[model samples]
Target: MASHQNLNFQGQIPGEFLIARIMQIHASISKLESLRPSKQVNILFSHLVKLCILPSSIDIKALPQEVQQMRQSLIILCARAESLLELEFATYLSKISLPLNDLNRFPYYENYVKLAKLEYGALIENTGVAQLKKVAFVGSGPMPLTSIILASQHMKSTHFDNIDIDETANNLARRIVSSDDEIEKRMKFLTSDIMEVKEKLGEYDCIILAALVGNEEEKAKILGHIRKYMKEGGVLLVRSAKGARAFLYPVVEEHELFDFKVLSIFHPTNDVINSVVLLRKSLIYT
Candidate 1:
């Protein structure tokens, strides 16, 4: 187990102590038999989440080369652990009688709710669209609570297409929302990689790239694909991370999104782990 003594939020330099703490957490997570939801793993991840939100004096980009590399590895490991937890909880809920209504039972359910509210507000303000016609969420996993919450709570009249590379995830997402007729009618789960859906990309009024979708290079590729195929003026919301939270998730750089016009980039200084970048496809592509 990693020691939390150094994280006393004192005058200690963040980069120095953070590296040691990160290595400890990395070693602990690596020893886990699987990233599945277990008592030990959950405890470790909970600590990691708290560590990420701690006040840090040094920026992630200022870390040394080797430390940065290790941090990237830790980020990937954390993403996997998060995905497994979502899958495990989604699978569990799918077997229950009323899964959609009971979604708040999941530990991170409120996080998704907060994220949905943030993204919905950004879409409305940036796009000036009171109700979107069709929206596509790329990399929506087994428990697509974001899409469900957005559809049910924010945009009741909008249609959402939940796209994922894993068919099983898509099936599980379908089952999780099957009980809600309104959301079920508005939500469509499609099993296809976002890269392969170039032909149909233009149909969406908005496309959201989930935070755990890919690594830096993969996200760049997906962004390039969206820039080329998505309709002009369509909004694209890419989930990102800033400050210490970048250690938990891959950060999206503005340079990678040169083709689009950035409308808003919000970095929450709170418990919300994922920052959001709102971009509009340029009407005149260079």
Candidate 2:
């Protein structure tokens, strides 16, 4: 029965149809904003998280590239929905759950690893950064994959610090990092909000900002606080924007960092249209 249903899904869920479905849900939420975040809509989002939001990595692995993109597009839609409706229905879907029975791995597992390498490489290859000896990751949620990847790449002398406002998330990230021996030796977690982070952890060559950080106002405040403490030429490896993802993962526009110079940028198409931005803290006289 399950096999038959999976086949049926593939038959109907073409690239265009999948894209349309996502747009349709987005439209519905926009039109029914008041009702969309209520209890009734929570059920709808739950179903989307369960049945539709997942990445069809295995199912569409051999399919056309376009179809594979559609599979990821669905994941993006669910992520956006969760971000928007979290206040009203925080528990509608849990953290990035592993697929049942060792199902499909992360949609872009290799791509993500590769991009993480590039983000690290950019930090090292850029002018100001010789070695990313001290790294800090902000807004690291339960699974601090970026921290793991970035931290793992460097030697033991390098240290990585990750902080999140959510205590639960901080604990989870710490546990996950501890499980991996390579990353565990260097990674540390702090349960503190980015805005309140006044500690002079010395000079961090690189600081990464997760895309899932809250709205623009909060982001500006965080940036402002960090700027006050960061050293000149200190690099910020931030997540930049792509099209409408600004609605959820508000991209740190270059304009926002009037005191920082844009170094380089990388874009990858996945759950969230993500851009790895490399920035250098600069002296701004305005």
Q: lDDT per prediction?
A: 0.86, 0.58
TM-score of each: 0.94, 0.63
Error of 2 at 190 (Å): 0.1
Segments of candidate 2 deviating more than 4 angstroms? 1-22, 27-108, 128-130, 154-157, 244-248, 268-272, 284-286
Error (Å) of candidate 2 at residue 159 is 0.9
Candidate 2 per-residue lDDT over residues 167-249, each given as its tens digit: 76666555555545766788888888777777553467778887767554567777777877877777777775543333234
**Pairs of residues at least 3 apart in sequence or in different chains that clash in candidate 2:** none
lDDT of 1 at 245: 81
What's the distance in Å from true for residue 238, model 1?
0.3
Error of model 1, residue 92, in angstroms: 1.1
For candidate 1, what is the lDDT? 0.86
